[model samples]
Target: MTRSFSWWAALGRTLLCLVFLQSLLGKMGGFGAVAAQMQQRGLPIPAVVLAVSMALMAVGSVLVISGWRQRLGAALLLVFLVPATLVFHTALEDPQERIQLFKNLAIMGGLLLVIDREAPSDRPVRR
Candidate 1:
């Protein structure tokens, strides 16, 4: 790859992880609020789930930004996003909620692209 391409790729990776990195502060500082939100949604073991999700986001963001095990990082984000989108943004009656749902979906799509672009060796072998 050209030097410019390398620089752009690094920038893109950092930008992709920005959301997760920014969220870490809110998640860490407002742990009780996040847990309460999950509990209100009727999710089981809200505190444990919130903790695990925060950990995954933290680790995944680091991996993605550093371009080490990026596919795993993207996969972890995707896993967290899928359920989060469904559980938190399912209120079709509220326009704001609908918008948030689509935003999450778009983020999921980007992560999917990241996962798909992984190196061939990073992918599982076909039978």
Candidate 2:
């Protein structure tokens, strides 16, 4: 890849992982609060879910940033994002919640692009 393409791709991947990294940090600092929020959402095994979510976010962010198993990372983020959007941001009656839902959707769109992009190993030989 050319230098420009490499730079842009790295920037894009970093930006995409930013939200997950920030969220994982926040969740780490307030595990109880996150678990409580999960419980309030009527989710079962709140603690387990919280732990798993954190793990996915951390691992997914690393994978995306390192450009290794990036599609798997994006998939993991989707697995986390889908239910999060439904459970936390589905209150269309509230404007803020509606915006949050759209924000999550946009993030998912970015992730889909990342997932669809060809990995180095998947690229065919040019010569």
Candidate 3:
């Protein structure tokens, strides 16, 4: 039973790793265009935010894929994704936009599932 659980956990982690890695690659490849889009959208701190996000996604994906410090990597990845889901992928009046919006939401839901078993509040907080 334990062995089966381990296998399933590993498979789930692998799926998450692949998704995160591909997303990181896409973001890196289109950094310039994303920055331009941010600017067009009148987003504040466009360049700085994009640069930080690129770093977080790239490095965090690598760590998550390697299963080294996975919890930390997942935490970092969520920081970028939560805001991205709200800011960039919000549902608008267009069908295409709604699809994109739900895509991010779905990804976020997957990430939440793949994260540490205990929610953050379940962890001991140090003063």
Candidate 4:
């Protein structure tokens, strides 16, 4: 790839992870409140779920940003997004919720592209 293309692609990857990274940072600052909110949503073991979600966000963001394991990273984010979108953004009556739902769908689409593009099965196995 050309230098410009590499730079732009890296930027795109970083942008794709921007939301997860931001949320991870926010959750770090308000862990108890976020866990309590998860509990209020009827999630079992809210603290554990929140911790796993945060770990997925952080690790997935790193993997994607570094381009070392893009498929796995994107898949991890997809795992997090599915339940999150359903649990938190399901208030279709609210305009903001509708917007958030569609936004998450778009993000999911991008992650799918990354997974397909970075499929390790398509590459030759290293000895």
Total clashes for model 2:
0
lDDT of candidate 1 vs native?
A: 0.84
Writing each residue's lDDT as its tens digit, candidate 1 over 75-113 gives 999888899888889999999999999888888887888
Best-to-worst lDDT order: 4, 2, 1, 3
Task: Give per-residue CA lDDT, model 4, range 5-30, as digits (tens).
Answer: 37877889999999999999999999
Kindly report which residue stretches of model 1 are placed more than 4 angstroms away from their true locations once superposed: 1-5, 120-127
Cα RMSD for candidates in order: 4.2, 2.6, 5.6, 4.2
**TM-scores for candidates 1 onward, in order:** 0.86, 0.89, 0.72, 0.89
Residues 1-127 of candidate 2: C-alpha lDDT, one tens digit per residue: 5223487888899999999999999999999998998998899999999999998899888988888788899999999999889889989999999999999999999999989997557789898
Candidate 2: clashing pairs of residues: none
lDDT, residue 21, model 4: 95
Off by over 4 Å in 4: 1-5, 118-127
C-alpha lDDT (0 to 100) for residue 100 of candidate 4: 98
Best by lDDT: 4
Candidate 3 per-residue C-alpha lDDT over 60-83 given as tens digits, one digit per residue, 9 for 90 to 100? 676665666667777788888888
In candidate 2, residue 93 scores what lDDT? 97
